[model samples]
Target: MFGKKEFAMSVHHRSARFLHHHPVAQVLTVFSFWLIGEALVRVLGNPLPGGIVGLGLLLVLLAMRRISTLSMRRGAGWFLSDMLLFFVPAVLAVLDHPELFGLTGLKILFVILASTALVMLATAFTVDRCWKYLGDRKEREHA
Candidate 1:
């Protein structure tokens, strides 16, 4: 006969193991957050896209320690690894627009390249600052 404590622990262990083994469930968990964001947007009549809201929500949850990074690691890794696939539709859609091959297209391409460079630079700077801040915090804690 199993004790109550043992039974609860057994259930928790089984659930943790199931989550660890099932990447699909992890992805669904991520998607559920997005759906929640979409519902919130619909209810609040916000102008921002659901995906952006969802990402912000996820970030806040992670920052506040409400969610463990490990819980989202596998799903986020899969999405990041296959991110190029997400842009395939946009690339294909460009073929349907003949004007994009002309001077207007060149201008758009230039803007895209410039914006990408700016975003990369900004991201690099932010990451470097965050790294330094974390390193300093750790050093202070140790001291």
Candidate 2:
């Protein structure tokens, strides 16, 4: 019964209201889902890290339309806006390893660069495959 535009507007309106009056609830909801995902990972005894598993769970929820990302967007935005703050501790910890910057530093730097390049290449390939699969699926559906 709901038109797509109307449904989208209603979702937007609900999200705005959530952001305005229940921001804490929104944050808690996100945290709770992540916590549940972490629990699932632990219970399954999977090698994958809890954060990654949690993210996968969140992605599934979003894709299935079981949850609206609008509620989490503001809280995520707030955290990302101050993302540098999260890196401060890691940077400081890296400074603690003065030995890593000596002769072996060049080797370490090479490894870092190589690993970064490989990761980028792998991510690009994965994205390309996923895009092609999605495009093919759409074409088949239309046909």
Candidate 3:
């Protein structure tokens, strides 16, 4: 008894709701994007790591509005909350290497600290600019 337009809207709403409720699906969505990036790298022979490529692809899709941020919110939050887990293996690997306790290790530590600070600063600036841009756009649209 539903019209085409209504049916399409209904499906969209249902799927959006499903994504909102299911964190696993959101995570899978993120993983699938990564897989696509890996496939692209293998096919195109790009020098970048697959994870970086995958993130770039995700950024493009987001910027082009092909994907909605709301759908990724929960999954992103989950990842952020447990981000330390991702670095655990690296920490463990460092422990396995005795050479890392010398001056070389100190140099590596300093580089890691400096790079992390730079990345954090850059990310904060970028987020601030993006927030202002979106706010201004919304105001302009309303005016």
Candidate 4:
């Protein structure tokens, strides 16, 4: 039992080292998926944005075990950790466009609220549907 525990710990340590060694590789892996998504959009002329499509493709790959998040987690986490930095540019742009605040301020606020609510509803519905489907599958499997 002790030997097995030691081996498992060693494996975990090695995996951690592997992830740390080439952190940029993880970011590139993600970017490659996005590029592929963009290419697909250009070729297929999809109405959806390439970045969104790429994100969905990444999800599918992760779900199918074709891609592992192990290496990507650190890089992705770093990006998320400093996420507010990304909004700086957009915030600055809005600040520059002070004219937009004069006549269209309320309109922009309304649109932002409406879009946010729509996104929340859509996300909630998708999560509920997926949860139900998975729960039903588990029941069928047990039955």
Instruction: Give the least accurate 10-residue stretch of model 2, judged by summed lDDT.
Output: 15-24
TM-score for candidate 4? 0.55
**What TM-scores do the predictions have?**
0.63, 0.56, 0.63, 0.55
Candidate 4 segments whose C-alpha is farther than 4 A from its true place:
1-21, 100-143
For candidate 4, the per-residue lDDT at 74 reads 71
- The regions of model 1 sitting more than 4 angstroms off are 1-17, 107-143
Please give the RMSD to the true structure for each candidate, in Å.
Answer: 5.4, 8.1, 6.9, 8.7
Question: Which pairs clash (backbone N, Cα, C closer than 3 Å) in model 3?
Answer: none
For candidate 4, which ten residues in a row score worst on lDDT? Answer: 12-21
Better candidate number, 1 or 2, judged by lDDT: 1
lDDT of 3 at 21: 81
Better of 3 and 4 by TM-score: 3
Instruction: Name the lDDT value of residue 11 in candidate 4.
Output: 86
Task: Please report how far candidate 1 places residue 23 from its true position, in Å.
Answer: 1.5
User: Candidate 4, 115: how far from true, in Å?
Assistant: 11
Clashing pairs in 4: none
lDDT for each residue of candidate 2 in 1-143, tens digit (9 for 90 to 100): 99999999899788667655666776676677678878988899988877778788889988998667776776666666888997888877768788888978788999999999999999999999999999999999999
Model 3: per-residue Cα lDDT over 4-111, one tens digit each: 999998998898888888999998888888899899999999999888998998999889986788888888888889999999888888777888999889999999
TM-score of 2: 0.56
Candidate 1 residue pairs in clash (backbone atoms < 3 Å): none
Best of the two (1, 4) by TM-score: 1
Alpha-carbon lDDT, every model: 0.88, 0.81, 0.90, 0.83
| Model 4: per-residue Cα lDDT over 87-140, one tens digit each | 977877877788778768888888999999999999999999999999999999
Encode model 1's per-residue lDDT on 1-143: one tens digit a residue.
99999998888777667767788877887889899889989999999999889999999988998666777789888888999999988888878898999998999999999999999999999999999999999999999
